[model samples]
Target: MGWLRGDCVGRGSFATVNLAVCSQFTTPTVVKSSDVFSSSSLKNEKQVLDRLGLCPEIIRCFGDDYTTENGEDFYNLFLEYASGGTLFDQLKNHGGRLPESDVRRYIRSIIRGLAYIHDKGFVHCDIKLQNILVLGNGDVKIADFGLAKRTEEKQSMCECRGTPLSMSPESVNDNEYEPPADVWALGCAVVEMVTGKPAWNVKEGSNIFSLMLRIGLGDELPEVPNELSEAGKDFLSKCFVKDPRKRWTAEMLLKHPFVADNTLSSKTSSPRCHFDFPDWVSAGTASVPCSPESVEWSEWKFDSVRWSNCTSPVDRLRQLVTDKKPNWSESDSWCLVSRHQRTV
Candidate 1:
């Protein structure tokens, strides 16, 4: 499709996400681009999305292509643009914690997506709040599958994958990432949503080796927040089971009372009910060009001003305003400025 890439929206370790306007579509799409030689993760994500097919809780991938710009080859993967940003951003916007009702709705959607992924014989290695994107309608979708892997592949890999805080015990101990690992990550995500803190108690200068030992060899599990309801605590208990063999699967979690009772119909009552469209969409048309390069300053008079002394245009303006202060003593009358009042 013919498209024009706009400003950069996000930057990952290996790729850059930008807004793009396509000729064939009305809504803007996000394009993640990376150097052709370093785009293995992007290619893998595209393949995984294609294999998973259509799911409302999963981010949709459009297509991918290769282009040469500035004599450098780049691989671009097109995906649906999420207007409400990531779940982490949602938490930050709402003073760090989300209402339990909203958390239930989001968790239900995540479980559904996880169940589908598990059934497809894959494990999402990374399942943190940052990887979950919120929609304009207060719904959530799983995104960023760069660390995803097939079930069989996960067993053979010895290196750990995914964020340290969300890593399951088995993943850290044996590098075994399966459906249960995703469930553990889900538990971590839920704790974060309800308590506005990481499931693991990581300190500012904590050693990585010590943290790994605690997760892999220690008997303790992530503390279920006291703020959670009885059913919510039970649900987390099943997820935080140290034994991966005994941990509840995503399919089982869907039937749990904490999330099973909640429905998308409650979205109207959610605190984040208002729409958050992108800045570009809300910015209306301008009569004159708005770019800095298009500005003309030749008409303004700079009387007895040393241009060399002024570092910027703002400094020049400040100097001019200070020099031309109004003489209040010469005025016979003064006008009071008050906030405009509307009449019913």
Candidate 2:
């Protein structure tokens, strides 16, 4: 089906995410596009999503296509649009922290998604609040599978695949990204949700190397919020285990009392909130600015003879001045000091 691209909602280092409406659907969808040459990650995401297929807890991918605009080719992947934005957005709306009840609901959904991915022999290398999308009905789904890989795939040494704040001990030390590492990241997300702060106590301007050392070798774990219920704390305990082997798996966490209890309503009764694209400077479409015919390009041009590959200090100083004389203004002239002025 043909789709019309709408406002550009987001831009990453390698891709642009825009709202789109397909001819066959009434609801708007999201189209993530990247230049054909830099689309490997997007293509990988499409393949992984297709392999995992049809899990309600996971984000749905409609399909992908190649399109050309302004003589440039782009690869586009269509995704289910989450009008409610991300879990991080919800946290900002709710005063930086979510109620325990809400946290439980969200965590339950995430665990279910993780369980499914792990069961499929895949590991979601990155799992954080920003990666979780909330639907209009308050249901959350796991999104952004760019870093996902098969569970059996061995990670290269010294390569970190996720945000450092959420990195598990095993991931930090051994570059191992297994299912348990995701659970550790899940624990970080849980703490952030409950306290409205990062799980790790990383101070401003703190050395990242030292932090990694602490995470991998210092035997320190994120402090569980005292405000949390005993069951909630216990649940976090299972996730924060330093040893990956002992860490509770997603399947195991699903049965924990904190999440297993379904008496509490999981759905939000409030109306679905739409994200305001404040960061989007353009409307309808992204366009490149055309040079105005009124401006003279020749006047702005510099003499090619003025530049060179010289690296000496004298050469650098010579390059700073131009052949043309400076147009000095009134302010450029130094004021003469009065004779009455005394030296300080």
Candidate 3:
């Protein structure tokens, strides 16, 4: 496959993604390549994508090959080009957080992909906004399967892979995991989509040990984004359950109010909200190390109702700040305010 490689688009620990075009094809595509000696492991990812071929919500893989550039032998994988880039880029474009409706649509697509992958006996060990690719039509597809493995593959105890902030509690603690671990990561991605921040309050250069303790050993979980709807919060509660045995499966979560269509009845039960803090996290010897940017969230209200109007001064203030337009006299502004207030 003598495809002409063009500009480099992405760089990761294992591979570099570049724009590529073939003589027979009219559209630009992306090719991910890594040194043959590097551990990026394109072979495994190619196998996973090949087995999971033709999913509308998953990035398509054309084929793979070997190429040498500048005396280095490299293995390469060709993938569908997501013109809209990644979900992480999308979130940044929206000023850190995406609108709830967009988040709902993206999450629904992701669930479909996850369901298919799990049904096929594989787990997408890494599920984060950065691995989610947005298409030109605004649809999203799950990408980057380098860390994925078969459900039957035994994991080492306390084995951690993928991004730290998006990892599941079980992955952080016992290191034993199954499909539910992806659901946990999905929950973290949703929180990031809504809050423009990682699920933990910890920040850059903070104590990673403390972060892991909070995620794995605590009765406390990641803070639900304040901007999310009650249904959204409840949905996260299901994903963040301490017990994977009791966690909602992707099939079950599809019917959750947060992701289901408006006409679809949400038969989802209330998310579990109680647990004892792990002994290590609760040891009063020292407060968990935190960053200056760390945020403290209050208890989430599972039974809260959405507000339909700016019925109070506080609501008005919230509207003004969130909408970013303080024009009180314009009816259009009032409409904007009401629209966002409904998300409360």
Per-prediction TM-score: 0.75, 0.75, 0.76
Cα lDDT computed for each candidate against the true fold: 0.69, 0.70, 0.68
The numbered model that scores best in TM-score is: 3
Please write out the lDDT profile of model 1 over residues 39-107, one tens digit for every residue.
777888999999999999999999999988899999999988888989877887887788999899899
Q: Which ranges of candidate 3 are over 4 A from the true structure?
A: 24-27, 263-344
**How far does residue 65 in candidate 1 sit from its true spot (Å)?**
0.4
| Location of the lowest summed lDDT over 10 successive residues in candidate 1 | 297-306
RMSD of each: 20.4, 18.5, 15.6
* Residue 239 lDDT, candidate 1, scale 0-100: 84
Candidate 1 lDDT at 116 equals 96
Model 2: colliding residue pairs? none
Give model 2's TM-score versus the native structure: 0.75
Candidate 2 local lDDT, 70-180, one digit each (tens): 999999999999999889779878877788999999999999999999999899887888789999999999998877889979744423456556888887666788999
Candidate 3 residue-wise lDDT, 198-278, digit = tens: 676653233334455667775777777656776777788778777887777888788776787654333433434343111
Which residue segments of model 2 deviate by more than 4 Å?
263-344
